[model samples]
Target: TPTAVASTIKAKNYIKTITYDNSQEDFVEKWLDQVFSEALQIRSDNKFTDEVPQRYEVPIIGFDCLKSATTLIFMNLKSNKYEIIDRPGPRSCPIHIIVKSTENSIHLKFIDAKNYVSADMELDDFLRDIGKVEPCESLIKESWLLLSAIDNRIKDYTDYHIDLLQNASLAKLSCLKKYAYCYKNFNISSCYNPEDKANPFDLSMRYWKSKVNSYNEQDKRKKRRIDHNITYDDYQHFHDVFLTQRCHMCQARFTYNNKPTLDRIVNEKSHTKINVLPCCPYCNNLPMTISNQEVYDSLRNDMRNIKISDCAIRKPYLRIASQLNQKRRDVNAQHHYKWLTLQQIIQNMDYIHVTDDDTDSLCLAIAH
Candidate 1:
């Protein structure tokens, strides 16, 4: 709001400080430090003048100025606290005197909803030029989409400007949303066209994408190291065992209790067919943080009694209850004839397909 001080012709002794709120673009604070302080001194030494009524109510002036991003509403520190000054609109000026004090050598800075941009305004001229750089609507929209993709900001594409107005995540995507909303609402035909090589937002988007790509590659490498030997068939076979009965590790009944997963018998060993077993995710994870001296089986079994745990099985987890509807839901035959238990195994034995080589290994597991 210190925008007023920039246009001041003479020096002043009464106005102490000015502040800026950047509703349109961010460059005012820097402009104020490098340019506005001297302007205030000049304007104040000569005389103070306002294009509009100087005696307008502070609240009304503040509200109008914010919408147009024209005037600065500041306090007169030298005067009573109740007296708020609404300065002349920012026509070509960047800083306006929002507040004044008896102690002189005026200073102005920008403050936004988040934080200050800089401590001192050494680069004020460079900063002020930012306000003059008018970016095109199409460029803004294009950059907005690019940034959105990087941030993974999922929202309704159809009528998103209206539909996603209430999204809390929009706050993080403010800059992109600002351009998008502006393009949807305003006529951008007169806005200054950006040069092919000097688009700042485009540069920012490229930097963001680079970081995202680097992170993705690192994550892929880590995943590759973790499951290099675990094949698709191994996973399907593990699920087959888990769906049929309790976890082979701790004998925990599987009613979505930590939902089953495959884990290595020895963390140091590769995920060979013999090394992996169907265990609850919670039991499997114990080996990662348990005592380093403990064997995998000892560590896994130590915390296996914990029945309540969570698992994020991204893949489809199909349940195997043998013959799901072959027989009626006969409560009377629950013991031996008609249930999702072992008796259904008899009816669905053909689906089991126990190979001769695996017969001994599956005997105790199937009985459980």
Candidate 2:
């Protein structure tokens, strides 16, 4: 009965993405026309299905941006609940749009409902700054809605990290649990020795403290009060106790030469527990200026032919990323701090090569 109820609920909540070609002139007008056509189709489809559970909901819209300006419209369901009307005349709901702008054109990227409202505000600010707000008044009003309607379940940083740890691998999960247990009574300071080079955790903590101090110094120079209130215990609880076996950015397993280090996800932010994550030394050495989106784009471009469910980096992609990272540094050195663009990285892919011969050696070089 539970399975049957789930099936019925799924059937009633199922909604498809309606796409349109925005390449032609008067694309906005054509998009509106196609939206109307989809509504008509929904009404017609409902006529054949007498079951309310089988009725269609409002479909999302995706625009082809390869040849034209990309504008993707997604459904903003209130409280993550799809409105399944018993007596619906073509189901309708609010829409969320993403507009990614380049030098000459704009494209759309897939974003969830939570980001929809922020995207709207960003779009509004952009339009207003460029003095084009009046022209897009109707467009903005139709698509944008107050984010207060959506329920935000993320209460604090602990909740966020707890969710992140839920997505950890089994190996990582086991290590985390074990480390957390061991660290409860473990005296980290007792493990530190001035003469011991083998003590990585101690050395890593020293380095982390130095970096945090440097960040605070920079804030002092900027006349901002040093807000980096992170303690050694916080580091122990969040970072050192995690027993990270893989790089959070590239998912590369840690080796003897590639040990874990805390990398700041956002450099401008403090080295608080929430801002840092375990990253391999190799990945940590990569260009610090690279945005999270740029890294994803680079990886996606390199692994276009590979089948990956969550964009997890393979050995070959990892090598490619390393090469691109080197390229970024070289360009920065030659061009005076200019970050390499995604297109440049993609263009250099033909020159980048990786081999699987070191698999045995890599597996052997696993960190303790």
The CA lDDT of each predicted structure is: 0.31, 0.34
Off by over 4 Å in 1: 1-228, 288-368
State the local distance difference test value for candidate 2: 0.34
lDDT of 2 by residue, 1-368 (tens): 00000000011335333323334544444444444444455445434332222222233221111112122122221222112222212123222333322221222222233222233344334334322333244422323221111112112213212221121122333333333343344332231111312323433566556656765676567565456545554545544443444466555544444456667766666555677677766555554443455454445443321234332331212221221233333333213112222112222221122212222211101011
Q: Output the lDDT of residue 264, model 2.
A: 70
lDDT of residue 80 for candidate 2: 20
TM-scores for all candidates? 0.19, 0.27
| Decoy 2 TM-score against native | 0.27
User: What would the per-residue lDDT of candidate 1 be over residues 22-51, giving only the tens digit for each residue?
Assistant: 442433434334343454444444332423
Q: Report how far residue 202 has shifted in candidate 2, in Å.
A: 6.1
RMSD of 2: 22.1
